[model samples]
Target: MTGTFKKIRRRVWLILNILVVFWMLAGVLCMQVPPSEFWPAGFVALSLPGALVLNFLFLLYWVFRRSWLLVLPLAALLLGWNYYGRLLAINFAEEVPKEAKTLQVLSFNTHVFNAYDKIVEGVPQVSNDMVDWVATHPADVFCLQEFYSRVNSIEYNNFNRIGTRYGKYKFVSTLETDRIKANLGIVIFSKYPILQGGTIHFLNKQRESANRAAWADLDVNGDTVRIYAVHLQSMSIKSEDIENTYSAIGNEESFKKEGRNVARRLKRGFIARAQQVEQLLEHVRQSPYPAIVCGDFNDIPFSYTYQELAEELENAFVKAGNGVGATYNGPLPFLRIDNQFYSPGLRAVSFETHYEMGLSDHFPISATYVLEPKAAE
Candidate 1:
């Protein structure tokens, strides 16, 4: 009887080990594949965090069991070091040099600065708080996504308020929607003079809301730096999806339906973002000056959108940030959809995500960079 029990335990362990290996392989494949509309790779990419955790658990299990299988998860982790680094970093007390010619940039998605809530509740407290925060947090440049402004509204003009807050700064924006009474778009406010700026409109199939990539050529002292502020295709996740995902355990049918809906949205977003990134990359390559890309990518670090962008630029978070560096404030807490990427000509000195501000669904990310004169030329 004891021998039979031991046999059953060994078989169970073997089965679990095989499952871990399969998941690890899937995670590795996700890292290698470029997510496209035709071949959607986000489902595999989404499995990565769980795979990593499972691998770590396996490593510990094998270690305690005194088994040679410990090497399997160890090897898997070593292979995906690049992906791990992007998810977390340990900078070891690195500090920015005081004398360096630095530029501070803040990227945020303000969820229309709570304008909807204000319109519904007859209270503008959240918008007022955000405006006050912007007035105090003195960044050299601000790349804002889901920005809202009104040209003819009787109550408030957020655009003018933000632009006029800093006496030395100039601002530019492009609407992502065609609302005549209000402007819903992305915006860039810079302390430096903007030489030229424009918007790249993306092709939307559903035509619900327009998404765009906006660029500005800023003369930063003696050097020209091109900045691209992009708001990619959103997943279109509704509150119902979140509730369904959480309550999915008991009812299989409802769970499956919600799962399908969520997956469909993710797949669509992944495809749309891929097309948008291709266009944005071409625009970046053609720029004569050093480029700094900042915005809410609406995708994860492990997705194809990030991989394509990372191939051309340095991720500021990986260069200078610490911890998981999550920027999204939602039901899915681990998502880091907001990012800052810079050309080789600039060195990211410090990168941070401000979580204290609760005005929006996205926590603001900021990075300070110094120009490398030789590389700039």
Candidate 2:
């Protein structure tokens, strides 16, 4: 009877260890493969946090059991240290005096400032709050995604108001949807003079009106720094999709359909973003000046879109931020989709994710950088 119990326990332990091995391999592959090579890997990448947590539990279990199995997860963790660092960091906070040479930049996805809100009584209250926030917390550069404004509409003139409020700064935007009555796109307001600016449109047939990258060449204190404010391919997960996902407990058929829909959307987004990243990287490489890229990437830290960009630029969050800097504020709170990456020539002094204001589905991210003298020259 005791032997039978011991045999059962051993079998369960073996199964658990096998599951850990599978997840660990998947997590490692996520860091190595680009979604361009195999799009399915991107989905695996998204499950990395879950894999990490499970491995941690396994590590604890093996420690208590005084078994040599602890080495499996411990080695996997050590091997994936670079990928883990991008998701979370431990930095001791210290007072770093603001220097005259530092450039402060903020990136935010305003979600049209809740202009289409129905659940909320006041439609534009969030919009008004965001405007007020921008007016007060001024930065050298503001890269905004999903920015919207309606012509002659008092409540929707946020685009004009923001530009007028920051009158001294140069404002550049890509008007993807330029209708007679309204406009929607990405915008960049820079304290420095904008010498040149343009947009890089994705060639996908199913592209959204706001899916594109806008860039500006700013003359910052006699230095020409090119900055790209980009909005990548969205997952297109509608409210109904969220509802279906949550309420799929009882109906098996409905659950399967909803799962397929969500997976299809994600797969499409991954492929489109892969193509977009290649084009954007080409554009960045052609730039004559040092570059700083900021906006809602719509991809997590372990994604191919991030890996490609990180290969060319330095992530501001990984450099100066502390903790899991999750920028996406939604049902899934652990997603840090919005990001800021700068050329190696700039040093990130500070990085912050603002979550206090619930104006949009994304938390605003800001980073201060000091340009190296040689790069500035």
Question: For model 1, how does the per-residue alpha-carbon lDDT over 345-370 read when each residue is reduced to its tens digit?
Answer: 89887888998897788999999899
Model 2: worst 10 consecutive residues (lDDT sum): 118-127
> Could you give me the TM-score of model 2 versus the true structure?
0.89
What is candidate 2's lDDT per residue for 1-377, written digit by digit as tens? 99999778967886787697688677667756767678888888777777777877777888888878788878877886777788697765545555546788989988877766633443333367876686567688888888877756676576567776667454556463433345677888877888889998876754544488999988988878888999998978876787888899688998999999999999888888888888889999998888889999998887788888988899999989999999987877678999999886787878999988667888999998887678334
User: Which ten contiguous residues of candidate 1 have the minimum total lDDT?
Assistant: 117-126
- Per-candidate TM-scores read 0.90, 0.89
The positional error of residue 168 in candidate 1, measured at the CA in angstroms, is: 4.4
So what's the TM-score on candidate 1?
0.90
The segments of candidate 2 whose C-alpha lies over 4 angstroms from its true place after superposition are 1-15, 30-37, 94-100, 118-126, 153-155, 176-180, 205-210, 375-377
Clashes of each: 0, 0
- Which numbered prediction scores highest in TM-score against the true structure? 1
